[model samples]
Target: MTTALSPVDPDSYRALMAAHPGGVAVVTTDDGLGTPYGFACTAWCGVSLDPPLLLVCASTTGSTLPVLAGRGWFAVNLLHGAGRRAADAFAHRDAGRFSAVPWRPSPATGLPLLPEDAHTAAECRVHRLDPVGDHTVIIGEIVRTTTTRGADQPPLLYGMRRYATWPVP
Candidate 1:
């Protein structure tokens, strides 16, 4: 069954999404100029298993969005508990996003993959694209993956007003 809510304001939608905690990740790819581009995204998700698919959303106006959408390959570097700063750095429209962060190449996709706080890395190839509101949902097929030293490290969570760590129970 499908359900719908009464039409709400955009702020309400933002507020609602803000209330739901999400794991952080940096999606990166080279822009064909030997220069890498990336952005922090909380909208990344696993989409399928048989084809090894994943999805990441990018704002229509984001500078790096075009590069990522045009590139055939990209990498999703899952952020660990200490990656809050890295997230903030990449989230902005700045040229120094990579200068402050450390990364290496993904053997499968040849994309830049974060080497630190990258609890998990997924090298992917673009599979499909869907326009959703003000963002584009880019679906990819995972080609390679790695689990870093922080397999047990709590993921950096974004919700409401700030970053948080999952409590150990």
Candidate 2:
């Protein structure tokens, strides 16, 4: 049984989520065709380690969701501080996402990994996809991982509707 509310207040929900900081990442993949697809995602985390699993949340209605589902593979590119530009570019609904950004396909999963803007990249195979509300939870089993940051640049953090870096103390 499910309770149906009369009206859903999205503003308050948005405000609540916005109050918490989240690390940014770009999820990229390609269709069996030559076309590539990607998007900026903030809802991500690792769920297990023995089998090496992680999860990323994306809108079920996003154009790239089908590509990810069909291919059963994707790359999670952890964006560094310098990747805000790339994040914004991918956030928009358009083609040519990789036109200006430098990227390469992951060796393990053949998913697109942005080396130019990402601090690290993880190639994963889809373990399962669970649809929750308006979003799909992509549970992945990490097959390959690499870091290009050289332990210097920290990943971008999004909070209060802005991009930032972790504070140095």
Candidate 3:
């Protein structure tokens, strides 16, 4: 069960959110005719284990959202420290997001994917889109996954206004 609450203090909410470490990821999609689009995201969440669902939140005003709308397919690249440049480049509104990065298609899913060196990547077929507050929740069914480091590599993490990681000891 859940309870209702008053409007949050924006500053306090921001601070609280910053305290929580989030794994960095980049969501990408293409028009399938050469035009590609994507953005850096940290709001990825797994929704279900039975149906293999994943969720990602994106702003309505973002550049990639338009291209992704109703496309029914996308790829999520989990970033490591080496992917910081990729994350920054995709965060912009330029039309050259894919061109700036080296990428290829997933063999199993035929979805456009990043090069083999990312920590991991997943190809997803979108299941639904839900609007919540200032963002849209993108729900996708994970069709295939490819990984180089699996759980062994330390992922790029963001917390308290910076990037971070804690290697397994």
Candidate 4:
């Protein structure tokens, strides 16, 4: 029962996960200087309901990681099926990601909110940050949430190294 298995290579692991689809979200934060930072993320999920906890994994080398860790707050903008462009914009690591994306500040925490692309947005206070391998798992306690789009709208998804939309019938 305690047989040790060989570690999987990075490329192999990536290939395995590419078969599993997940919803897309843009994780955003500010540098406390009015400059915003964000990245398109698929590694996120709800953790608990009682305390309203959710987790999003940020790349260790990502630019937004330091800012959000220092600021102690962030926003999660859940993309709709029509938000492929916004997702693509933030997916790249660059300083101009926000130039084309229309956004406003969240009411509660003043974090960047994707008003046009996001179907649902959550403002959170960072509860814990755990560094795991090449990514840091950010656990957030949801402070405020907003639903900007209707339930009939499908969610944007990523899998098989491509972007796809959930089939809503």
Candidate 2 residue-wise lDDT, 63-153, digit = tens: 9888999988888999988888889888888787788688887766667888889989888889999999999999999989889953378
Comparing candidate 1 with candidate 3, which one achieves the higher TM-score? 1
Name the candidate that leads on lDDT: 4
Clashes of each: 0, 0, 0, 0
What global local distance difference test value does model 3 have? 0.80
Clashing pairs in 1: none
Ranking by lDDT: 4, 2, 1, 3
Candidate 3 on 16-84: residue-level lDDT in tens?
Answer: 989998988889887767567788888998999989999999889887777787567888988876677
Model 1 TM-score, 2 decimals: 0.90
Residue 64 miss distance in model 2 (angstroms): 1.0
Show the colliding residue pairs in model 2: none
* Candidate 2 residue spans exceeding 4 A from truth: 1-8
Q: What's each prediction's TM-score?
A: 0.90, 0.91, 0.86, 0.95
Q: Would you list the C-alpha lDDT of every candidate in the order shown?
A: 0.86, 0.87, 0.80, 0.92
Candidate 4 stretches with Cα past 4 Å from truth are 1-4
lDDT comparison, 1 vs 4, better candidate = 4
